[model samples]
Target: MLEVADIFRAHGPTWRRTVSLSLGQLKVMSAIEQCRSAALGGHVLRCSGCARTEIAYNSCRNRHCPKCQGSAARRWLEARQADLLPVGYYHVVFTLPAAISAIAWHNKTVIYGLLFDIAAQTLRTIAADPRHLGAQIGATLVLHTWGSALTHHPHVHGIVPGGGLSSGGERWIACRPGFFLPVRVLSRLFRRRFLEALTDAHRRGQLQFFGEHAALADRATFAQWLAPLRTCEWFVYAKRPFAGPQAVLAYLSRYTHRVAISNQRLLAFDERGVTFRWKDYRATGRTRYKTMTLQASEFMRRFLLHVLPAGFHRIRHYGLLANPVRRDNLAKVRDLLHVAPRFDPPSDDTVIQAQPVFICRHCGAPMIVIDIVARTAPIRAPPMSRGAT
Candidate 1:
């Protein structure tokens, strides 16, 4: 099983010398290389039942590191569990055309922000219209900027309730079962709103261009560039409703914290380069699942293409679920639907025992922390000749 850390530790230094990287990229590479290694420091875990000992290295805990997101994803999912609504949940996706993908790559913050804002606006406006659902909807929007082949494909995954509150806020208005708003309506609205927002940003000098797109710095050139996209059919899809609230949570767990690639997908690394698996949506059967080898440098470049702008939020909630009034809105909707309040229970007076972070591999027994480790001190390594316990 090849790990992302193995690739970085082996070739990262050479790649760093060859290609320039942003501060974020550098930090991400450093974090992945040092993750779960002696460099970051860790404590020793002694098994209570078997008397076996092991050294547990600490993780980098970087959001971008593939090895470090399991615990983070679990924590985030736990927090979102309470926010689930007991109603049909629809999965909506809004994707930008290839023409705009170039501009988005260079001006990620401005363009991506517009993408989030316009997509959310489209959903809210369409749902509020009497011709559509005629109600105010809430959605959790997650931004994904990469395709399976590691290309720059910007899209937003929206988790929306099948219904919304009426304009007067008096009652809940539910859409027909298994179907949400029309995709055509959402697509057209998203295209118009996104173009309007992008043009506004360009006019205000908020967008930047380079290389072949340098001509786009001119207003007329940019307008001409965006002309064809105005009428083209933007990709907007609505998947079938989730089975239940638990299904929604399960879906969120997988999508919300994903990176461009995971360690499991990595196959091997050698003088030739890195070999990894990729899925081709355009193909079928065995042909769809194939492996490709790229020069280590090229692989790193593709991975770094998705390093988002500093402090740019990739996950957002809008409409009824927006942060400003989420609690009050949830309460109101729950009351209208006659759903009972669900929350964390009060802490009991009983003293809880601290749990171990790792267990003994041999005996499956609890491994208690016997000593604390400080980073400045020497690495506490286990005996080199110890037999397998």
Candidate 2:
């Protein structure tokens, strides 16, 4: 199995040459490398049943750290469980034209926000139209900034209800049985709404373009570039509706805490640069897992390009799922679904609030920490925890 350290050891120095490190990303990498080890403070755990030892260090808990996202996903899923509606859910993707993608890369904060805002607005407006479904839909939008190959591919993944409350709020209006929304209409509306927002931003001088965007900064040039997009078809894909509520939750769980890449996909690394397996969408079954090499600096640059602005939310809720009405909407949904009332449990007084658990994977025996290690000094490693299983 290849670890992140192996890849870095193989190509990190070369990447450092051309990859400009933002103060923020440099701090993130340093933190990830130091996390949950003796570089910080560590505590010893001893098994009561046997003389087993385990050493546990503090986790950096940075959102960008690949090691930390698993626990974060679990916690986020637990919270979202209450928000789940007992109905079929749809997964829709809204993407921008390549021409707009260039500007998006430069003005990530503004353009990304515009993408979310306009897409949400379009869906709500269209769904509420009497000629359409005429319902107030609820959705959660998740932003993903990378492709399977780790290239910059910004898009939004939406989890929307199969139906919504009618305009009169008297009855539930279901979409055409399995489908939640029309993809063709969604594409056109999404493109128009996005361009409208972009145009407004440009008029207000809220957008900035550099290098490639230099020509776009000119009013006439920008207008000319945007003019062709009005008639151009945008990409809006609708995945088959989820099998059930659990599937929806499971799917959302995967995207909610995902980073650029997971550890499992990393294959190997060497002086030539990092080589990792990526799925080629154009290829069929057997040839999908293709390996690609990137200059280390290029890899680092692509990785850091995705760090969102501080306090900007990558996951957002709209309509019923919006924070203000979430609790009430959830209760109503449960009632409509004939689910039992949610029960409140008394808080546990005797349960320990926090305890580090490091147990052997094979034998289910606990590990105890018999020795402590400091970053400044290296010494003998303690024996493996009792049977290490």
Candidate 3:
């Protein structure tokens, strides 16, 4: 059983009584509790070699449920393998200034969308400049709203093909083997574009603030807040180029379908509270794994804060991979790279058939279910302790 199950089993009822009565948290609790358990159904497998039997429970398969992401990650990796191109890939991260995080929390849909737009536009615009790459770049951007400690830290992780087609489509602009775009320029352009969009949103009344950030509600106050942002160093960190296109797809496999936390990271749960390991960037030397204790209600609040609106996509494709012209552009790219178009055969393995389950937990030998545990009804209480009324 996962730590989340133990935590939920112990405190989940109290949380339902204290917090907003909603199905979301309940469903999450149910998924976490039933993960890797027969309650959600399973299979019985019998080994022929030794006549050993095993019972394996199925996973909830919920994206937000930590226990289910393992297989999801694997399946995603396999699918991405087909999209890999034989070219160098770049890892570019775009992060927003801290001040915007509050407003982003309130208007997640709008601001998150803006984050994607600005990042994509900044890259495409820079790459199109004749003095720079002067080409069209293809990339995938994934939005991550939480840091390791479950704080509201939003950023975009982009895996870009290092080289691209020239403006006239006559030649390719292959980036320097070790470099893609200059960080300084990318940072400047990214800051300018992002701030400009933010200012526009503020003017158009698309942003709202209250409580601690209420001062930002005033137009002049907001301008003052935005003024220092440009001078501040907006981070645009780029990792060394990946060996080739296969690496790009592989990198996406790790980040694209990821959730807030994973079962493996959970350490333990007890009567005091829940404890889990998280990365603390502030510390020096080896990054330390720290634990946090929270009341069940507080935990539920923090966890549910990350549930995105329905149908909002956290992963997006741009440039050559954009849906409208993906096939046509991919063909052109294959021709330019001198690689023959290879079609992937229909996959027979994607049909998630039931796995056989019939196994003994203590020994490898086959075991039969000889008994069933049934719930017993509560016994009627004898007349209440008679204190003469």
Among these predicted structures, which one has the highest lDDT? 1
Q: TM-score, each model?
A: 0.92, 0.87, 0.80
Query: Residue 300 in candidate 3 has what lDDT?
Result: 58
RMSD of each: 6.4, 7.2, 7.0
lDDT of 3 by residue, 1-389 (tens): 45656666677665655555335445666677666665655566655445565566677776677667767777777766656667788899998878887678877877899989889888888888878788998878999888887778889999888888877666667887898888889899999988888888889998888788888978999999889897999988899998766666667767887887666777666666666778887886665667777665566567766766556888888997776877777678778889875655658876665543354555554545433333232111112223423
* Model 1 TM-score, all chains together: 0.92
Candidate 3 local distance difference test against the native: 0.74
- Clashing residue pairs, backbone N/CA/C < 3 A, model 1: none
Ranking by lDDT: 1, 2, 3
Full-model lDDT for every candidate: 0.86, 0.76, 0.74
> Which candidate ranks first by TM-score, i.e. highest?
1
**lDDT (Cα, 0-100) at 318 in candidate 2:** 94
The TM-score that candidate 3 achieves is 0.80
